[model samples]
Target: MSEQADLKRTPLWDAHRRLGARMVPFGGWDMPVQYATGILAEAKAVRTTAGLFDVSHMGRLEVHGPTAREALESLTPNVIGKLALKKGHYTLFLNERGGVIDDLIVYCQEPNLYKLIVNASNTEKDCAWIQSHLPAGSVLTNRTPDTALLALQGPLAVTIMAAAGAPEASEIRRFERVAVRLFNNPAWAMRTGYTGEDGFEIQCSATSAENLWNALLRVAGPNLVPCGLGARDVLRIEAAYPLYGHEIDDDCNPWEAGLGWVLKKTEGFIGAEALARLKESQARQLVGLTMETRSVARQGATVLAGDRPCGEVVSGTFSPNVNASIALAYVDRDVTDETLTVESGGRRQNAARTPLPFVDLPVARKKKPAGLTSTASL
Candidate 1:
């Protein structure tokens, strides 16, 4: 690991290689894009059963002080004022113009302590931004190198967690965290995931991560397939979850990205003034689109309303679960029910405005033990 290679390798690098994973460079790290089972199969496995992901490549940081929440509020959009201890939330770091710098999950470890999980590529920039805006009493520490993240997702994810002796696992609600013992080691398990399924994101010490990973695989056996970024991308797209650089970026604000709901207008925070202005202007809107033909619309594709170009596609993919080509794009708000056209592969195809989550699953209705209410929320 060179100090200036613009790339970092996670602790599970060797383990992924041993598992015959196809290694690729992501955010300067050697990451597994997929395994021998391939992306389509892995996506199907997660939609049906469970899929395990090695997200150790992501970044983790700790903020400790009496004014931790206040300091964070100055940098992100989520209302940290009401966040209870041991709870976590999805938030975004905004620039002065209300543009998104990055999306992150903030964990309220204690009244005065917070843990921030961020995208791998934005670790340095995010840390610098947070540190620069911290109050006099606040302290920020980078813990990415010492922590490991593992996500177990799917309909049967809870079953695997319960079988692993995670008594509190069944009780953790969505977006909630609980300190539990897994494989006889201490771990912070959060009932949350990106696959839009019932699952948990377990954070543990780097030293014991491999042990827990192996134990999970053993417990899951054939049901839990080890998925990689390829499937993760597809699954998130299917669920209409936004991706950092694609769906949003430093050039796009929350309202333009279909994330205005995350902003609390009452709580004055950084970029609030600019966001209010953008809301008043409201020139564009984010929407989901389904192609009328079999052709797939990809990122950067041109979205046309009649003969005029209205907007551009952001994140898109051929939905394996829906068996159709779907895409998400930023279009003119005037484009309401009108049939539009998407230019892809040197051809234009008919597309229709549609609701998100092209494929909906009713897995949440399934019954589990009473103590598992916490996991259900995740």
Candidate 2:
């Protein structure tokens, strides 16, 4: 009772209960892990048609000042000074020792204002760290408490937007955000999502969240299903997107973790010097693995190359999209064996080294002309 009482609930908490969502504690919040449709079904819906997610638990912050650009440039590895208005890029914040503080998206909302969305678990830490680094005149405001974020993800998401009273949302390019209307209410809509699907993440006031959520569902009708965190986790994992504490963390190396792309210019950010110094010593490569058996390998499970312990699993789950249990792990860069085994629960399961993104992203899949069909039964 005390634990439940201590957990915070999002604006749509009661709505989730009404939909028969299974509640679980996540990042100090009582969130829905899955709905009545189940995790697999919800995940499949996102990959096929569309799915709606209540991602209000993520932290939203706004920074404003004449020195905002300079302050952000000094803090992240990605180049922030070049971001045009309404454009956002994935970036990272690191400690002086080259350790990741958090991975977040930095958006240029205005000439002097920027919006940041940080991980739910890292929100407080990120706020303190960011606030301390800003210039004297710069100000940081935590908008998470007053914001409600909803993600409409899948192939049908774009079509659903216009019907949901946000026609402008469909025109927003990827990574570009715009102020739009959701069911006639103002919203901040961005063409971004974590599910490796085409979608938009809509941010609105907490007071408008429930109304917006219901309106979108009503407009989409049967095309969109309500998804929960369990499906969200599976989708992100299948896409090989790193979770904060899993693939990338304080002890993890961006270079070895295949996150070198985020380092747009390696020598400018706070951790550049340390990263340059430690690159050679961090000799592990983040790799994807698919289990040969039904056994699921979880984080901290030991990876072995023929009998020698080579690495450990960082994140793993049964991917319904891939039809197998898959995992991401860090292994010795010199280890060349593709066949590996994960030892957990007193047993070893054979797993084969697979490429990242066990499932192909929707954008990469081929399409046919509107009237074309794939070789009819003639």
Candidate 3:
């Protein structure tokens, strides 16, 4: 219970409490980690049907003006110049040493306007970093406090959104966004999600959150249930999405985390040179592991080969959908693509290094038209 005076609360705080959520402190906010249905149930719901999450805790920053695009391109490694309007992609904020500051989604809304959705815990730090690097004619605004974000995820999410009166939802492709009016209030519907499911992340004003939430629930009725952080964590881990502190941090670079695809060396961004060097000398590689036994390997659990430690678990869970214990771990570069072991519940269990994304994503990547450049999908 984060009852501290300084702890922040989202606009949906009251609704969560009313629905019997188990509140806990997350990123300095009193957030719901699970509701009466519990983490596993919520995780299953999202995997099978649909689940709604109050992700208002995330930070939303708007940047626009003459040099906004150039300034943003200079801050991150991704090629912002190629990001078409209404398109968004996952990228990272990194330090000069190629260390991750945070991973975020950047959306190019218009010619000179963009929106950055960043992690809640590092919102202030990210804002300050942006301020320090602001280009002469660009403007930055923190829109977190006045916004409410909801993730409607799963196979049936499209149906739910359609029922909620957003028929344009089906027209939005993955990584694309559209400005729309929902429940008579202005909103942005983006075909993106943290969970591995096909979904839409809806952003609306804080003042309208309650009504919107209620309307969504009424429309989505038995198909969509409220989920919380616990389920969110399990879903993300199952999807092989790295959490900031768990799989990456200030001391880690993108290459070590298996996210090298997003790094563009030619862009010459802040950490480009350092990342290029580290890519040559990369020592560790993040990989997915499936345990042979039923025991769950937890974060920080030492991965062993015979008697020697080779790596450690960064994220782990008993996946209900997979019907097995799965985890993400970092091992020495030479130790990757091999079977290993981890001590769980005082027993050593055999673990096999598996390809990332323990589960297939609900929406497959749209194949580029033959001979066309790949900018649209990135």
Candidate 4:
């Protein structure tokens, strides 16, 4: 591991250290992996109540122009033009060979303007790719340095936001974003999160980040548990959300990750032809696994059918909610409904085919209302 002085840090670095968080290096940044209370407690808090996460490490970009939508659509598998104002959806960026570059959330702030929130690890690469493919006259602003992100997640998330002087936040439905005054500071609250729970991702100016976090802690009071990347990872894994460099990467396509729904087949984007070929001639596919024993299957663990190795584990964990070991793995397209095994510590443990998302999501995407609000009060 590199020295702490060599790594980048978010504005909330000091706050995390003060809380006795366990710091670690992630994507060239020094971040908190877990707090003193531990990952299990923090993850369970998000499941039953609410938890706060400093996600400022993630990248943010603002794009706008007459050709912005079309330009973005050309780079991603999702249909950017079809995205409605103030709405956001999960999308994937692909390489020329149809492999996933990164999975991100694209929010339509206006007809021609959009807000892109991408993974921390792929920030630089994703920005460079977008800039290189940007149309003439289109504008791209990297707001990662100027902005700070916080996720207030779980069933009690809305209540916490409403109590924190952002009553408008409670009104924000799934996949919607609204700009409002949080702790009297300008902030954007998106009704989206990676925890598979009903929550909001709030973005505020870097200058007001600590104040906003402190204010939210006070407002949320005893209901708020400060979570770290460790808990965040476990939660997303339980939700079956793909993480870059893990479940999906530059060498893997959406089809292999069970994310074919994000692909717009008719709309020709970058790598569309490659994806079309994969669709016609399917190969390996991502699937869920439930271990029959207590042994947890780790990443890169070989999955087997009897004596034959068939797949490899992408992400696996001992699920707190499920009270069992679960995993996501990629196996041959022909393999289905067969008993499988995973090798851990030279011992082959029994596993069975299970559905994606070991646990069901508490929140579902809401339908867009007929009359959309044009102006967001900030």
Best-performing candidate as measured by TM-score: 2
Query: Residue 285 CA error for candidate 1 (Å)?
Result: 1.7
Tens digit of per-residue lDDT, candidate 3, span 1-378: 336667899999999999999998899888999999989899999989999999999999999998999989999988888999999999999899999999999999998999999999989999999999998999999999999999999999988877877877887978898987777678999999999899999999999998898888888888899999999998998899989999999899998987888886444678877876787898888989999976889999999876788889999998877888999998888874478989856779899888879888766556568568566334
lDDT by residue (109-167, candidate 2, tens digit) is 99999999999999999999988898887999999999899999999998999888776
Poorest stretch of ten by lDDT in candidate 2: 369-378
User: Could you give the C-alpha RMSD of every candidate to the true structure, in order shown?
Assistant: 3.3, 4.1, 3.4, 3.6
C-alpha local distance difference test of each model:
0.86, 0.90, 0.89, 0.87
Better of 1 and 3 by TM-score: 3
Best by lDDT: 2
Candidate 1, number of clashes: 11
Rank by TM-score (best first) = 2, 3, 4, 1
Better structure of 1 and 3 per lDDT: 3
**Model 4: runs farther than 4 Å from truth?**
365-378
lDDT of 1 by residue, 1-378 (tens): 353365577878788888999988888788999999998899999989999999988889899999897899878778887788889899998888888989999989899999889998899999899888889999999998998999999988888988888866877878898998887889989988888888999999999988898899998899999999999998888888888888889988888777887886444677888887777777777788888876779899999998789998997877778777888888887777567899967899988888876667443356677687656566
Candidate 2: residue pairs that collide: none
TM agreement with the true structure for every prediction: 0.92, 0.95, 0.94, 0.93
Runs of candidate 3 with Cα error greater than 4 angstroms are 1-3, 344-346, 365-378
TM-score of 1: 0.92
Any residue pairs clashing in model 4, and if so which?
A: none
State the weakest 10-residue window (summed lDDT) of model 4: 369-378
